[model samples]
Target: MTTLVKLDHVTRRFGDITALDDVSLEIDSGRIVGLLGPNGAGKTTLLSLVQGLRRASSGTVELFGGSPADARTRRHLGCTPQETALPPTLRVGEVIDFVGAHFDNAVPREELAAEFGISELLKRQTGALSGGQKRRLSVALAFVGRPRLVLLDEPTTGLDVDGRRALWAAVHRQQDAGATVVVTSHYLEEIEALAERVIVIGQGRVLVDDDLSAVLDQVGLRLLRLTTPTPDRVRALTGVVDSRPEHDGSFTFFVQDADVAVAELVRSGIQFSGLTVRGATLEEAFLTLIADSPKQNDAAGVSPRGI
Candidate 1:
């Protein structure tokens, strides 16, 4: 596979704050890779370096086998950041044209708009559209240049269910057309739906990088949710990785093995009810990684936000 983007021992800082630390990864061509992390986990900082919007503080960032800082190297790249501010006065078609004008042989506005399910809004001014519609337009603009590598940060932030699904379909189509996509989303289900490989970041460092199934399986955890009168004792149960009390007077336990954990709970004579055990979802695994990270920098004050 072709390596489209590479970061070697990269670190980025804002004043005294380190947003990304000693990061090294390669984004291969034609894969939908999900970048998963909590807020302020340095996801955006990494993407910014890839897009040449910011320079790495200590190491190298390469795009298309060249420096990301070079305009020529980024010609085949497209990015939709966490926040998009479209010109209110510009019509949807006008905005597409404006962004497309910078690239050679850009996709036609009509074609690009149709692919992203925004064809009907072409005549409307950006200010007049709904939040979902505006988000669709913003994402569509990224593909106007027919990029080979697309970086999408929180692409479906404001979209409804159907809208989000439609964008997922659009993303699949992009991948089918031989584009590499890097997506960062708070929605773990979104990553599960669209990504084959997952790279999880936490505390300004990579915590997990593996195939989707491997990442899930590696956690080897089960979620046990039950209403226990003695929540404090439930948290200290053997095999429990972490425990959280739900808003509705229930405790959720992340356990190494549900059966063993449940057996231990029952043997201990804890008064609990409404017990349900299931395999840990991506969200659970991601959270477990963050909580168990050797480098716990969350207490170090807020840094950059990825989405």
Candidate 2:
């Protein structure tokens, strides 16, 4: 697997504000990578730099072993921004056709439209389409050229559950066809399902870059739901981190060690109707990473409404 993209000590600034600070990362070909972060965390800035939409203030940005601005590199990269601007008067098919023409060898316009369920919408004017339809059309445009690398920013925005599932299928199809995908999404579950590797960003810096499973392991909190009659006794246990009793009399405990905690509960002579332990979810890991960072303090000054 060759390196498809690399950012070496890259930094981007806007006057006194630092959007990215000494960020370094490498993404390989044929892998789906998730670029995740809270608002103002530079996830979009990083993508913009990599796609050549903006220049880095310091260090280097490379795509396909060449500068991002290189024509050859551009041919292999496709970007779907969070907000896509479409010509109001143009029909959906016309927009895709126009974008596809930019590449030397584009995917068939009809095929791309059909893949995203936008075939029926091809004849409709871009402005007349619903938000979900517009989102689908934007995604279709990104796939028009069948580029080796695709960058999707908040791809699932404004999509309902069914629409999101449809988009996920299209993404999986791209991965199956050997394209490298970099997605930044607000939906943690979507990232967990689509990305093999996860990169978390905070304060314009990389917080964690590793296999999804490995990153989850670092945040080792588990939720244990038990149907014990002695909920009070379980709450009294010293090892239990936090315990809350449900209306149904069941107790759910947040614990650091499931095996040891359960053993202790059993030894306390409590009979449980059921005991289940669930590992930390990607959402839990994401929140933990952001909360633990010193940058969280800076977030306070950015207006409470925005934070």
- Which one wins on lDDT? 1
CA lDDT, candidate 2, residue 41 = 88
Clashing pairs in 1: none
lDDT of candidate 1 over 86-164, digit per residue (tens): 8889899999999899899899999999898888999998889898888888788778788999999899997889999
What are the models' TM-scores?
0.91, 0.80
lDDT values for all models = 0.86, 0.81
**Top TM-score hit:** 1
Runs of candidate 2 with Cα error greater than 4 angstroms are: 223-255, 258-279, 297-307
Runs of candidate 1 exceeding 4 Å displacement: 81-84, 229-233, 294-307
* Residue 273 miss distance in model 1 (angstroms): 3.5
Clashes of 2: 0
What is candidate 1's TM-score against the reference? 0.91
